[model samples]
Target chain A: MVNSWLELGAQKKDTPVKHNYSIFRRNCLMGIVLAVLLMSGPQRSWGQSEKPSIDFFSGFEVGLYDFYFYQKYNVVFNLTPGFKWNMGNHWQLAGQARLTVINQLSNDVRRFYPSMLVLSKELKAGPVYLKGSVGAFSNSRYGFDLKAFLPVTPWLAFEAQAGLTGLLTMAGGWGMSPMGRFTGTVGGDIYLSRWNTQLRGVVGKYVYTDWGFQAEAMRHFNHATVGLYAKWNNIAGQLGQEGVSLTQSLAKGMDGGFKVTIMLPPYKRTHRTVNFRPASHYSLTYLVRGMAQYRDANQLYYTDPEENMRDGWFSRDLLKWGSHTMEPDFIYKGKEETE
Target chain B: MKRIKISYILLAAMVLLPSLSHAQQYNGTSGFLHIPSAEMSHEGDARMGVHYLNKALLPDTGFLFQGEKYNTYDFYLGITPFEWIELSFTSTRRKDTRAVTGEVGFWRKDRYASIKIRPLREGRYHPAVAIGFNDVGTTAFNKERTDVQLYFTNIYVAATKHFGFGGNELGVNLAYRHYFRNYNDKWSGLVGGLSFRPAFFPQGRAIVEYMGNEFLIGADALLWQHVLIQASLIDFKYLNLGLCLQLNMLGKKYVVAER
Candidate 1:
């Protein structure tokens, strides 16, 4: 009403055709503002239409590792009850509980504690994508992690990842260690969409202070994925206190294995505030390494629970949709096709 | 000419109907008794069940920590993610007759995985062939000593061919298994199996297989389209039983190639 009165006063001064057009434009702007306010309800501010949502995921966590001091292999199976809260604006808070049902883990570690409690955010700036998270994460660590990616083409990309974390064990009770370890990696990926294949390689420092490179070749199905991966760490072939040459490690210290991950049923879910379902994916990896090689500091740790090659959050189709669809040539082609 | 076309259609239906009558083996694979044939189920088929195992079934070719002379329960699950691959996970119990303590049960299950890859398909001129491995990621405990033993690890290559004798069908499976770690010659060398299904009783099958110098004769039947029942006599002494339930991942029937 106040804007209308001001427009009326301006009209009394200049009754021109240009004055009428300006008033018409001002009315349209006011209508948009009013519509936004009405759609957001009384609880939300402008441009914040997304509401906080909750997600419940159920699955089992399988921990298979070589080199148990007493046993040959360490197997830990836990029922994972995960919860996620989407705070909107590309931020989410997720955590899963680890209630050990069966285990042959180190010293028969029986744990019922939080597996992960992290807050992560993702942002896209032009062709660059950035993501960061902070809190207690998987692989028994608590700290901050950051990831950045730049796409060279639709099917090829490069990324850099870094993290700083410390030991976190909840076997008998709350046990913590000094947060002083730093690990980082630079990686590249080549995706072949025709065959639904991915080839990725990452090189840098591992959490065990081992500098190495890991490569993977994965095949993706609609709801399943299978892959083969190899690892080579500089600490593997080291004799005494002196590190061996890179050539020796590459030849004699190489280790590889196969991995299979399958997605459970109910691929689609109803949109609701609270949703609970079984785990979406189950992963089993068979790494070929002896106790000597395992103890040589070629171990690996993870911060993200959903990190994978093909059937992961950042799949080939999704990554391509974000990058390839925005190109000028494809944008014009899309418009033509739509028309 | 029209009558001849109808007769051909009837013959095709009779030939393709038996493919839907496949049942799960005692080891939870898609084949006969203890033998795994090269023919797989639908690509998305998933199966889960339990079996009643007799401790005396493979006495001479058994684990070092053999349990008492009794029956035990074993749980297993299998899935076919692709037409050429079959993956299975099992938690099989090894009886420990030496466990005089009361801290645990008489037997404890050790989880293991197995995979089979069918690379060659049966055509007009060739039989289907598959290669498989059991106990995939097991680490050899105490490699130099006898404290811990690698009990069950076998790698095998199998080929199967189907023959149609009038309205009845017969499948012959030939496989060579190579056992590793503890018992290298337990079920080693060549083995064969036979499966026969009459056209009038397509839901039932007669299976006979030999492994470890022992013959296992069994009868398998499918009930209600999804439940599989098996009863086998191992070496003509011990009785082994199995019951399983399976379904296609999409709640559909078999694929066109198999159908």
Candidate 2:
């Protein structure tokens, strides 16, 4: 099933500059470390020998923004044109540009900005897929964001991202400075029959330890995939209003949305589908290939005539793996030499 | 003798460790996007991608240290229609003024086309090889004038390799560039550098290079796989910051079968 989310928020607040910088640095370091560990994890070995594919497509997105979870409304219209290059070996690079037009009920001036641009690189490392990107709005640095998906099982995967926007808070304030705040989203996805569902617990400065749940059911036609979803959010922080009980937090932040995304095909080697595959690439490939070609270890393979003939087609010793064992008498007897 | 044996034992264990894991697999070469380094990874985006790189500082008022820094923004769009071949268009901002003083009123820009072709994939014994041209258009700030200050054409050959032990990977890049400039001296020398990404955080890298007779050091941080922030120091005195957003254009999909 195809599932995605488009979230936008902005606010401004004055905080201690040193504290903000420290928090940003710490989180940045933590994000990098986590990416490394995830990439280095044990991987499943699903692979296709084919090369990667490339394409360009465009779509439109419309969202109704509800202020105070009430009737106050602002509508946002976005024209998103995207270019994607799936570099067959689990590395995908995509760039997206957003031409956003916002119509606010509170203001007469229609705000339209063609300033949103994003470039992203995604690596499917082992069981975890990590994506990091830089975004620019109006020729200035907008912010940086990262999303990671870790599969616990075939049907369940854990998801998390740095959702550092605090407009989700109720002070009628917004901060558009990206990566300026330290917040994160922690959640999991359940792939049921015909449905992909997400239940997330988000914490940090913005959401203030809130809970969000989303359920999307998607259907595919010949070209496009359409999905409808309803999301409900609950914040652990109290609303400070008098007589507000526990149920108020749950009932107040209800949002229902639907999205129609069309995909045009040539999907043979694209691997952009919802299907999961075993990862073939890892960091150890380099080290193993390097050490295996060390002088003394390579001597055993070249000395034997049959071994040399079998590996002759390959130019580098690192590529001659089958018969380069440490044994001095190792021979290339094919399958019979297994022991 | 004891220390040598211990080192050998450690090296042996490292090579054999991956064999113990039955499930682990090697995906392919991994490295940064755009911001080229001496490290060779055969992997690139499959389609067309656009990136914008900005050089943070240029001296205002022409060489005399007016205590003012000029910002030069470069918009670069690259497309790898084929895996090994990349064609790119770069538009750079150049400052021009015939008046010869303070905050030149005229800003001229030019577009240049370049191509990078990787002839061979990097192996343990051999580096990945590429040949490319920079400032191919020879487009200049002022073509009408008798003097053009910002026009130089260069063709370069580069070799990049990755050396890794466990999770630690270091990329070494060696490049030779031949500069074509008629106004000032001919015969440019070798330009090369090294890049390193820590094992703990592969998303960020530190790079140092000597290009065009100037020493440069910088770092690139990739966030969310889309945004790249680069900060560099040039010639020890000038600091430059570049921010780029990478975007991809996906071709129309044709679904042939229904699962």
Candidate 3:
């Protein structure tokens, strides 16, 4: 009699499962609607001038373990399509919409995070670039981030960022009690023609961290860029006082990963490429390198030929000094060389 | 309501004034992307151009929503003094809101000069190269807004190549621009565009531009011998329209077919 009573109770408990199904259906529908709307524009070739263009991006990443959830072996899938708009010579706006799906292989659990929207504004002035955005992350966290990049010299640039976010607990009993937090990053980029390195110090709530340091290096190829990053968190390991393993702090933790990005062509012209030039047009090796490559010095060293001619004034005579006889008469053609 | 009435009145005047001129010449070298072109206007030709940009279409909510009506008006007087050089003076007025405060009471007016120079001609394989300075003229104010410097300035250099295949012609232009200002002063970005005329519409042409950060789609059509109409959708939100009047300030010439 008791076993029959329990069976009846189990059948009565189907309402919650039905409710969860309804929520999942709603989210899927929303994603489909957004995808359709973004892809509905005219099919003509675009991004040819000072206007806005649309592009789509997707990424898949596998993590050995989730630092925050303490889950072993998880995979993340991201789909993002964005519109980039140029306001003027100095300003740009980008609307980024992203959907993320996280799957944990160990427990055979799958979770779908809500779509996120981010509007980022970028401004450039002289040697400084500023980027700020207000958006929600796929983790059901809403936030704003402000970042600035300042080029102290041609080969070195400093970057700083600060963000504020409010987290919401979700499936798997993770992120319980959802609290507000602040995060900051300070970094610098070292650039070479084909390679770049970033060293950053991060402090905030990312997989439970009071602070962390990261070093990343990327190599650029003709059509793709490959990068690897290593991170060390919380120099001192700290455990949560009252929480499960999922909420336990991952301080003093270490992790590393590799990423590859492929660029599609009919590429847009933007500062992302030009800013990599080395500072000081008078670098001795740059000229020799240009000559060795049989590249046009005008095209390689300057944005405009007129500017190239003017800049060559500095290194031209230097190049001629060793090439031709450095006679006093040849050197004193004008006193402006010394003045 | 009063502001809307004044806008209508101004637009009507702009459309009417172009009809007063009786020059039987339309300009073939007048089209530009969002920025001025490296190509000059017809030699010794002068024109008055007006442009209106309305950035008030997005809803007040989403990430792309621009809260208030942000509108701009640009009036340009452009002249081609030499076969390879063009000069333009522009008066621009903008009405926007304070970034932090939502009040729509902010307004600014700036007068600037634009200069373009074409140094190389198109050859069988080599493209035509042109260089230009955008918004070069400004009265001395703060160092940040100074426009006279060349390095880290608003300079754009472009190279255009024309390709003809089976009677269809397409012009591809690639440009590099560097701007010197706070936060935007250090680096340069690449932007390019394609210009072509449709077979069905011989009198009209379309320009598609990727200005590094955004994309612009627009069309320019000749309404009359001396009148040209220009319209564009900026970022798929604002509808920008323009009316240009060409006049023979110094010599007589008619629009020539683009080569």
lDDT of 2 by residue, A1-339 (tens): 000011222222445567656766765676566556545543442142124555455555464433321232356565655554555434444444555565443342223333334444445556566655444322222345566767676556676766332111111222233245444556654444222222333222223233455444433222222333444444321344567665674444434333333332333332332323211111100011111111111010011111122121111221212212222121222322311
Question: Candidate 2: where is the Cα deviation over 4 Å?
Answer: A1-339, B1-69, B96-106, B139-152, B182-187, B247-259
For candidate 3, give the lDDT of residue A206.
Answer: 43
Here, model 3's chain A TM-score works out at: 0.46
Worst 10 residues of 2 chain A by lDDT: A280-289
Candidate order by decreasing lDDT: 1, 3, 2
Candidate 1 chain A, poorest ten consecutive residues by summed lDDT:
A330-339
At residue A30, what lDDT does model 2 achieve? 61
Give the alpha carbon lDDT tens digit for every residue of B1-259 in model 2: 5634543454333333321000000011122222233332212222122222223233223322235434555555443433465555554555445233435532444445565677887776999888766554342223344454433345667788867766655677777766445432232567677776556556556667776456766565545545545555555444454454432333222211110
Q: Model 3: how many Å of interface RMSD?
A: 23.0
Q: Higher TM-score: candidate 1 or 2?
A: 1
Measured on C-alpha atoms, candidate 1 has an lDDT of 0.63
Off by over 4 Å in 3: A1-339, B1-31, B55-69, B96-108, B139-153, B182-188, B256-259
With candidate 1 superimposed using the best TM-score fit, by how many Å does residue A21's alpha carbon deviate from the native?
64
lDDT of 3 by residue, B1-259 (tens): 5655554454344333432121111112343546434445555566677766454311121112254445556676665645686666565554444455555532433445566789997788988888877555322222464443322126778888777654445778788877655334323588777876544444555667776666766666655556767655555444567777765533355543444
